[model samples]
Target: MTDDIRVLVIDDDFRVAGLHRDAVASVPGFTPLEAVHTLDAARQALRAHQPDLLLVDAYLPDGDGIRFVADTERDAFVLSAATDAVTVRRAINAGALAYLAKPFDAVALVDRLRRYARMRNLLGGDAALTQERIDRALSIMAGGAEPATVSRSATEQLILDGLGDDDEASAAEVAERVGISRATAQRHLAALATRGQVEVRLRYGTTGRPEHRYVRVGKR
Candidate 1:
């Protein structure tokens, strides 16, 4: 790649930052700029290196990574151990591109990094994106670029965004959220399940037949 994406890995833990640096380096179109431990160091490095992206942790000794990232205006994704909804919401509100809870396999992080690269390329083009281009690019971001046979339509993208790989939601719930028919939501969810993009399980209740709930598979 002519223009490799420069990345800085920022975390309070030295070992974790180094591991993330390696993961960022492993991707084809990404370059590891440097890994820093604290928010102060991250700021100095950011000013010095001006990396295109940041692999950030939410907790920093000097300051909050969410505020730092939001202030920086650079592309960022969080690799954090904080699993609370509040933290997740703050990260999202801070404009994090994506968030992964910690203690996860490095492979999962690499997958998201690669997906983000694809996303950057698609949306970062100088020319304005057409409607179809926007839809397809977002679809690829959600479902990934693999399994070329399985296509993700705009409706399916809505389902995936609502279903979010971290939690389980019933078809009706997803339908209501995305404003789609329950049957349509269920069909898309089933398609995603067949692709190993989601997990389907039976949710047993007090006095009814088991209801099928779909959960995203890669949140560990």
Candidate 2:
């Protein structure tokens, strides 16, 4: 990749397109070249700007986003809420580098984009396509490991890291530090508990039934 990697955001929802555009702009070595809400507009933008990367939605007003990826020269990734396995497989078949679910945090977007930038840089200008290169790209897209070895999401990782120092933290406290909801914090905590990473204790309150508090298993 060059010093500045240009990205085009294509989504039917203008708000979502803007969000993705802003996310790409916030990443280092990246520039948001255009935000288009339809496949037709995306094609026009692609012809005009020739971006280094394309972030396209699975659903578009004009046509299937996968078609755009199939026809475009730029590296593409799908950002959508659609979880159907068939759709995801089609996207992979269409040459999307990554398939990110919707409502992902900006940090996750940056991570994916940075990975793509690294892959592009490694290939260099005029680099020949090889089996090794294809394997590396697939590995990156598959989260760099087999399913069993893959780590948790960024939000989950943050929660785990935060729990590293403190043996215990309330859901409210975790939410405040992680910038998520208390319910979301609790759900993650429960998942960690299930995995034996932490232990939970119920603290009874005078005015209510009880509240759950979590503590790292080995820490305390």
Against the true structure, whose TM-score is highest? 1
Report how far off residue 43 is in candidate 1 (Å). 1.2
TM-score of model 1 vs. true structure = 0.64
The residue pairs that clash in candidate 1, if any, are none
**Clashing residue pairs for model 2:** 1-121
What range of 10 consecutive residues in model 2 has the weakest lDDT sum? 145-154
Error of 1 at 156 (Å): 21
Residue 66 alpha-carbon offset, candidate 1, angstroms: 0.8
lDDT (tens digit, per residue) of candidate 1 on 1-220: 1378899999989898888999888887789987998889888998898899898999899888989989998889988999999999998898887898998888988877866765554465376655755654566556543333334576576577666633778998776445445787888999989999878999899988999988877743
lDDT of each: 0.78, 0.75
